[model samples]
Structures are given as structure tokens and as C-alpha cells.
Target: MADKAVDALSENEARDELARLSDLLARANRAYHAEDAPDISDADYDRLKRRNAEIEARFAHLKRQDSPSEQVGAAPAEGFSKVRHAVRMMSLSNAFDDEDIDDFDASIRRYLGLSDSDPLRYTGEPKIDGLSLSLRYEHGRLIQAATRGDGSEGENVTANARTIADIPDTLSGAPEVLEVRGEVYMSHADFADLNARQSARGGKTFANPRNAAAGSLRQLDANITRDRPLRFFAYSWGELTAPLAETQVQAIARLKDLGFQTNPLTSLCDGPEQMLAHYRQIEKQRATLGYDIDGVVYKVNDLGFQARLGFRSTTPRWAIAHKFPAELAWTRLESIDIQVGRTGALSPVARLTPVTVGGVVVSNATLHNEDYIAGRDSEGNEIREGKDIRVGDWVQVYRAGDVIPKVADVDLGKRPKDAKPFEFPTTCPECGSDAIREEGDAVRRCSGGMICPAQAIEKLKHLVSRAAFDIEGLGAKQVEQFYTDGWVKEPADIFDLKEKFGSGIQQLKNREGWGEKSANNLFDAIDERRSIALGRVIFALGIRHVGESASNLLARHYGTWSVFESAMLEAAPMEGPAWDDLLSIDGVGKVMAQSLVSAMNQEAERASIDRLVAHLNIQEAERPATDGSPVAGKTVVFTGTLEKMSRAEAKARAESLGAKVSGSVSKKTDIVVAGPGAGSKEKKAQELGLTVLDEDGWLELIGG
Candidate 1:
């Protein structure tokens, strides 16, 4: 059956569905990876993801290899030496609801040929969202700490790993050799402070704590990695030269004895029912857990049974990740402030008294918009239900992990007598220019664009970013100088730099750190960068809604710079059919379309674009489609718990090879490649008339 038959949606409708899918997945990605608080219900997100996969599978030709459906996990990053695991690391199948868990238990019993009366003990622990690394110690001295790469291969970050306070540099009275696997994460407070410092320095702040840890740990310079406040929680082990324990519980206990930090939440269950109870208990207490936990991980407690029911390509047959229902918490509302993003959108922020929840402090959150703050829901109550959260009012805070915090609810009973509703400003907070809230949207944006000083400075910096022009001598300082000297105002002014600075550039030779050779080298480097990739050029144009990934998407979609530019101009001004159709392209959005039109409508911006285009040559190598790739647009589902590679890696590899790796499957799924003890996804695929493949087929498709 076709995806069209499944929904009978028109092209526009299909595009809308895809856009919603993209936004949903991206938000989930941010929540799971950056902030930790997942906004959408897990079951709903899973359904959307499955539907996305079905759509992509039905229309494989329209699918990008990098689609979010295929981006289930990330690959092990560079800067570390690679090491293959003795036993492959696999990820666990997940359950978002009690029914799902029940189904999972039923499947497990059936797979093991166990009667319902037979017992199966499980150990449940918090599932930490962080970088997964396997640490090896010889005679109790830490030797290596490698990321859970492609199960077999991972990069070594030994030096950086040693800096983690919880990881013992040496263990006393331990096994001759032990390979313990755990997660490396940044505490919520550390992440907040890091983002604050980055903001103060006018640098980009990370979206969440996990990203901060991931970015920090993957630093090329070990010293940089050392500066990060990283913590670890040992959950499982890979190998031990000597027997560490007779059971899984004892193995974890031994790991703790070897100076590893272990979660105290671990509990033994008599069977899947007890395991499910433990999962619920953890979910209820998730807000109090100091670290971010999206779900509870349950593993078979008996080592003998574990050995008998071993692993698949990327997951174990005996473990599952049972996710918690998304919840929102309440906090006191201190004040509301507006922030200007790089794109000049004025975002509303709520400040609150410091409170600790889920192992992190919460002092601020996103209010989203003035409408959100001032408007009301179906009931005759304020939109956020607390008279727009005036200063001193009590408000609710919610998160799944270290996410951009948001006020989930409010308590009017706790409001102070003197507290009054906040009056959102009509002018840009940064530039005093009149801000406009476009029809059909909540965001209030500054129409000033490059004319706004703050926006202008940020734009200049963006124009010369490494991915953009790659000008060696024209760094932020140089650009600032040029701006101050009135030698450069717009991006096009960069081309006239040589004529204006020809003599002054020679004077650069006399600067304390500059030599004639160095000065000339900088000029040559700038000249070399005059020609760049078409994607970079598109990105450098600073079109709103067009980010690095979107630029790449558009570049691949349009092929040529001329065609892309023409499309933009033609797409501008047109609102209904033409605009919607063009913007409906997978990566482009209405926000992006409006920005392009607004930018192009201005004569100054148009002139700058024409000037820059005439003076520069941008080219790109054609990327031919890899039709021969077996994994092309295939749907992959990772089940059970993995030991070698993190669940993220398995998903990333499948995607990089042109597969659509979704959390679940529907009728549109071309094939469902499942790991051990497949869960709801496998059953759904079967129900939807989809074919199922095993781990061996997955490996063959991925060319492993």
C-alpha cells in the first residue's frame, strides 16, 4: 500500500505532514539530547516517527539520507583512538506505556519458551542520557576510556577520561583487568554555568547539558576536555580477566568497589511485573533524580541466563528501556525578560527563584511569547493560567533533562497581592526598533535586520565564519575594526577591502606579532576564500530559517546557486499556492520563506547580494545518489539493550547509508530490521503488512 493511500493527503498535505514530522523530531532530539524535558508524549512522538518512516519508505526518492527518521543515533566522533569491543554494544528496545511494557513482557516470555508461571528476575536502573564510554583498567589503574563506537570500534579519550573525578585513576584490590561501561554527563548546574559564561562572552550557548558534555568530551584538545565538569555512572561491564561476580547485581557491586560511581536506584525484580513497577516508581521520582533520565533500564539479573540469551547486532535480548511519561513541575515566577536571538527574534524568558529538581538547578525557563503569556485557553483563565505570570507569582517548571526550561503551569493562590500582569514590550529590546508579530505566529521580531547594531555585528561575524568565507586576517577583531573605520558595512564591502587597505595591510607587518610573510599569507588566504562551496555561500547569505543542515538540504535540492537564487526571488511576494509549494520542500519552512522575502524586498539587501555574487565564484561538487546502497530508505528498529555501541551509533550508521531508521513502523515501512527480542515496532510492522529482517540482514545492508 502507498503512503498516499494510507492518508490520501495531497502534495501540500504530505509536505505539511513532513514538516510537522521534522519539527516534532527536531524538538524531541533537542529535548532528548539538549534540554532533557521531552514536550510531546513519548507514545505520540513514536507514532509520528513511525509515520514519518512509512511516508519516506513509500516515497524513497524524496528522502534525504540525513532525514531525522534515519538519524536515530549519532556516530562516535573523531579525536579519539578507535577500539573495538570484545562483545558488541547493543541498545535496548523501549516502551512508553504500560500496554507496551506488557506486550514486551509477553514477547520476552514467548521468545524464551517460558510459561507465565515461570520466574524472570530483572534489575532496573535509571537510564542516563550522556556520552557512553567503556573504561579499561589493568590491575586497577585506568588504561583506556573509549566511546561506544560502532560496537566494535570507538575513539580513545584516555587523558580526558582520567580527569573525571568519579573515575578512579587507580583501583585497589580489584580484578587484574576490567572493562566497565558507563555514561559521562555534565550536571545541570555545570551546564547552566557553562551556558551563562558562553552567553556573557557573546558565544553560542549549548542547547542542553548532554550536548555540552558531548561537545566537551569530543574536544580535540584534551586540556579543553579536562576543563569540563564531567561525571560518570557505571552501569555494566564488558569483560573481566578474573570473575567479578556470580550475578549481574554482584557485577555492578564489584564495579562500585573498583571506584566507579553507580546509581543507588538499581533494584532487583522478581519478574517483568516487578520490573514494570520499578519503572513506574522511577518515573514518579524522575523529577527528584539529580541527573537527567528519560527512562528506566531493566536488565536480566541472572548472569547464567544472560549468557544463554546473549546479544544481537546492537542490542541485548534481556534488557529494555521503559521511558517515563513526560511531566511538568511548578516553580515561583520571579520576572519576565525579552532576549534577542542571532536572527533578531525577541524571545520571552521567565526568571525564577533557584530550585533543584532532577539533579539540577532551575532558575529560568522559556515563556515562548507574549501571546502565550497573556492569552487564555478554552477556560476563561490566563493562557499560562496565572495572570500571565507577573513578577513574584508562583509558576511551574518542567524538563526531561537539561533542556531550555519552560514554565509549564502557574499557581494563582500563591500570587502576591501587589503582583500585576506583565506588559510585553512592542519595541525590540536590543535596538528600540518597532517589533512586529507576524500574522499567525507568536514570535515578535525586529524588522531592523542589518540596520540594527546588534544584528549587524552578529551578521558580520557570521559572514566570515570558517564555513563561510574563511578569511584568515578578517576575524571578528578585523571585522569590527573595518566596521568602526566605515570601510565595511555590508558583506559586499568585503570585496573592496584590498583597495582600501592595500597600504594599511603592509603596516600589519610592523604589528608586534606580524611579519611581512604572515601579513601576505593572511591576504592570500582571504583571496583563496573568495571562491567557496555553494552550500557555504547559501549559508553566508544569512537567510533566516536556513541553518547549516537546511542550507545543505536546499543546495542538494536545487543543485545550482543560480537556480536557488532565482527560486528564492520567484518564491518571494507570492503567498498562497506558489509560496506554500516552494516552501513545502522538506527543509524549508514558512519562517524561512518569510525571511528570504523580507531580506530580498529591501533594496539595500538586494544590492549587497548582487554585488557579492558578482565578485565571488561559488561552486559545489555534484553528489551522485548511491542507489546501490542496500540500506537505502529501509526502516531499522533497535531492540533490547546494547553493550558495545550506544543506541545512538546504530541509528547513525543506518542513516549514513541511506536508511530511514524510525522508532516504530507502519504499513509504509519497506522492511523492519529488528534486533533481539523485538518490541512494539516489530509487532506493528507485522500488523501493517511489513516484512521483518533480523540482525544479520541489518549488518548485510549496512555493509558491516
Candidate 2:
């Protein structure tokens, strides 16, 4: 019978690959549960949403009758108040290597069969990087809060989380509903006095403190999240109705007896060698703490062994995280310079003489290419061969963890040898052109993209940066005082700064710490960013393979900016599935598409994108799409462990969606979603037979 038609063509190719992995894991759970921004890489979208929940937990008659495995979060978004979570919140399993925290401590000592001497208490803490939310309460008064979405819906920001004072809003023994959860940060001395008053009112700052607490908790003005100091820590718990304690240290001493603030560096431990000695005494007091940690979570303290070791559909197989090995220091290089950028590259930098390591003060960093300033430092000596760092030597500096901080060893028997061997410049300090160095990379750049002037004032200070057009007055010290007073030079002279700073606003209202109510609050924060955000106009156009996670993956893959500038001016040569859909986008490679087609084939970078798209207004991106339709354009390609989203919101919802979300898997893949530890792009999309979906049939073919 020819084996019953080859088992009826392998059960109709497993029912058309479970209806294309439930339409690419319900369009990557409506681009990561009703989009805030994500496109893949939380290890390739948790290996195609854990192989679409292990093929809907092993073909429960081929699942998908509208499944994200019968969901939990994305429904109540329209204006808020949609409560139903009494306790499901979940989301916690990441380890990112150390063999995923020693296979999550040998799978909690093989599911509590326990081995070498029992006591395993654990605890640890400090994960923070903002915006998880939850908060509920009922008798404790603070009616709501929300935003974890898809762990069982979210986003009501109850009056901007009632302006967060460690989110109390009235508690003390008042429990009827509860909930709690946490992390809404912003500290490091209010992210350095909000980046020194957004650099003395020429606004636009805040690259961290979890993006100034998720842009001050999505403020449509809860008094701008009550004027932005915002802070919170309280860890875990998401639905009570009652039963307060029995440990997670008595539910963080009943969330500091219902007032909250919690994280006084948590602690407790007794096993996993005192949770790896309290993650090496919080990485040796992570540079005298006060905020921005990145890792050390731990947990376990037994809520009946985390309810008998439950949770695996995305982390909590009893908690882990770990992190650290990244903050190296040493100081004194004192001078090197170069810079340029907006695709002209030529970087170099150094400058040093400042210090403070992990908590900021880093006087000037990046020595990134010149084989990282001629190599060697964490003590094997040689920084330009022993202190020949020239312009005043003493070099060490490193910062390794969140990366970027080079110049490692250089003591050269602490030499000065009249410190010389200097001469690095091959030209283009600002615009003398000629820099060169191509043949297989180590940087060098500036063949003048936009006729130089320090690459048009570092591309108009990364197009009024602070995640772009955050333009208050225009800071980098007012774009180097409007490029040393010739008053702005490009990125459409920052929308002609209110007609050239309207006579430098009466000399910034008679100077000395300026007046006239802080120069009309820096002209109402540059007239509230003259309408922007297609991922801050593709991260204020500095381009060259872009950043801020490839400008939120090209504003969620061309949800506008004229269809991502007609696929970056594609006049031919982009081969196969449009070059495997622009190198299958997740953190893109091929040296970032040959530094974005050598900065759009130069001609002064196509006249600085036609003079910064003539005083900008290139918007479009808003897609959102979680259940109510729109994972934007679609093409998502993730791999293992994404229980519910956050590989930076699945590459910011595959770039707000016109679609092109790549990161390997080729022959022009249109959908390879995979997951449950998908390897080599699910074995090269099953040896090129291609289309392979999983992750709840990729959230029931995009309708999560």
C-alpha cells in the first residue's frame, strides 16, 4: 500500500506544520504581547516560543483553537481597568550562560531529590531594569497598576501607577486582592540629575536606568509620572486575596509591612554555596551600588519549594539570572580623541583622567578599534607598548560586563620613557578626509559621510538624541554650542532651533544658570519633540547599520519612514529573499550590511538624507497588535526559551512591523519561528524544506 501513502504524506506534513506554528506563535504573541517593542533575541525569541509550547504540549490533537496555549496576558489594553489576574503573572527563567546557571542548579537538585547535604535556602535580589508593574491591592487602597501584559494581560498604569513612591498609595493590613510584583527604577542619582538637566536644558538624555523607568512609566502625563524621579523594587507575588507569608522572607516582610521599597539588597541564602556567596557579595558592592545592576536574582527560599518546583513555560524552574563579569576599571589614558561617526566611523576616543567605574563618572571611553588601541591591558602590559599611550599615559580602563570600556593592561613597569610612540591619525580629525583602513576591518573610517565637520557634529548630536529628537534645547552641550556658534549645521539644523534660538533666547535669559523660568522650560522641551517616534525617527538618523537595537529593528521593519526608505534605497544587488530578508534582522550581521551599503553609497551620504528629510516628521510606527490584530508585517524568526516575551520586547515587536525580522536561517526564510531549544535555525529550517512555525503555532498564526 506504499506504507499508507507514506503515512498519508507524514500526516499532511504535520497538518501544514501545525498551521504554520499557529501563525508564527500568534504573530510572536502580537509582536510580544501587544507590542511595546521587540523583534527577536531573548535567544531567538525563546527558541520560537519554546517550540510553540512543545508543539502545544505534544499534539493535544494538534492544539491551536486560538492558542498561545490558552493565553494569560493581552486583552484589557483600551484605557486600562481590566483586573483578572488573581495570581498568574509568572515570567522568570533566563540565565544567559554559566551553563544556564549550572543547569539551573542541576534542575533544583533534580526536582528536590536533593544530593550533597540539603539546606538549599537561596534568596539574592537586585534585577530592577524597570517596568514590570502588577500592583493591584483592594483594601490596601491603591486600586490598580497593571503592565506585565500577556502573563495575564496588563497596561492600566492606574493614574501613572499613582505616581510611584515605592508604590504604596495607602496600605497597612488592608488586603482583599493584593498582587504586588515590582521594578520601576530610575535612580543612579535620578540618572545623574536626569542627565544633568538634559544637559543644561538643550534637552534629550537618558540612555539608561531602564530607559528612565520605561520613559517615566508611559506618561500621557500622570504629571509626567509625577515629575520623573520614579523608583520601586519590591520583588514578586502577583495575586493574593489573602495568605501573606511562609517565606520569600515573609513575602518581603509583607512588602515592607505594606508600604514597599523592599530591595535593601535582599539576601538570606544557605546553599548553592550561599547562592554563590551572595553573587560575589553583589559583585563586590557593584561600584558602591544605588542602581543599575543587570543581574544576581537567585530565589527558591521555599514557598513549599516554589509550589513543588512548578513553572517552565518561560523561567521560574525555581529562579536564576546570575550575571556580573563585565565592569573592569583602571584610568589615566588622558587623551586620544578622533570620533566622526554618522557612518564615517573613525572612532578612537580615550581621554580618561576621571574614574568611578560601574556607577558612571567614566571621563571618556571607547578605544574600540586600532586593534583596540594596539591591544593588551588587564595587566599583561603593552597599551601602545607600556604607557606609550602618549598624551599622558597611565592607561588601564576596561568595563567588560555591559561591554564597551577598552585599554586593558598598560603599566609597562609604570613607564613614561618620555611617553611617545603616539602618531595614530591618518587624517580626518574632523574633516581633512583620507582616514582609510578597510581591507577586513579594525575601523579607521571617515571617508567623509556628509562632508565631515566631525561627521556633521556627530550627526547633529545623534539627531537630538536621548533616544532621538528628545530635543529640549539640544544638549551634547547644546550640540557643542550649536557647533561652536555657527549655530547648528545639520539633521536639518534641529528644525532650525526656533528660528536659530530666537536671538539665543535673550542670551539664554541673561546666562548664569539661566532665568525666565529656565528659558521657558527650554522652549517647552523643544516644543515637545515636534512630533516623532518611528523608533525616534530611526534613532535620529545616524544610520550605518543603526543602533538602539537597530533603531527598534528599523522601526518594527518599515511601519513607515517611507517603507524604511524604500528598503534602504534598494537599486538591485540585495539577492535571494531580498538577501534573506535583509540578513534576517535579529541583531543583523555581514558587518551590519556592509555598514549599511557603505553609508548609502556616500555622495555625502546622499546629501545627509536629503537634508535630514527636510526638517523631519517621518512618523508611522504605532502597530501595538496583541489580540486585536497587527503583529505589523510579520516575518519573526526566534529560537529558544521565550516563555512570554522580552528579548527587548522581541526586537521591539519585529521593528513595529512592515516585517523583516532576521538572525540567520537563509534561502530567504519567510517564517522559521522554531523554539524549545531550536538549534542551527531549526537545523537550517529543516534542511531547507523551509517553513517551520511552533511557539503555539507562532501564536495561532498571528492572532495570539
Top-scoring candidate (lDDT): 1
What is the lDDT for 520 in model 2?
A: 74
lDDT of each: 0.68, 0.62
Q: Estimate each model's TM-score.
A: 0.56, 0.27
* lDDT (tens digit, per residue) of candidate 2 on 448-562: 6556777777677667644567555456666767677675676666566657768547766775656777777776776667677777776577664355445665576667877
Clashes of each: 29, 70
Q: Which candidate is the best by TM-score?
A: 1
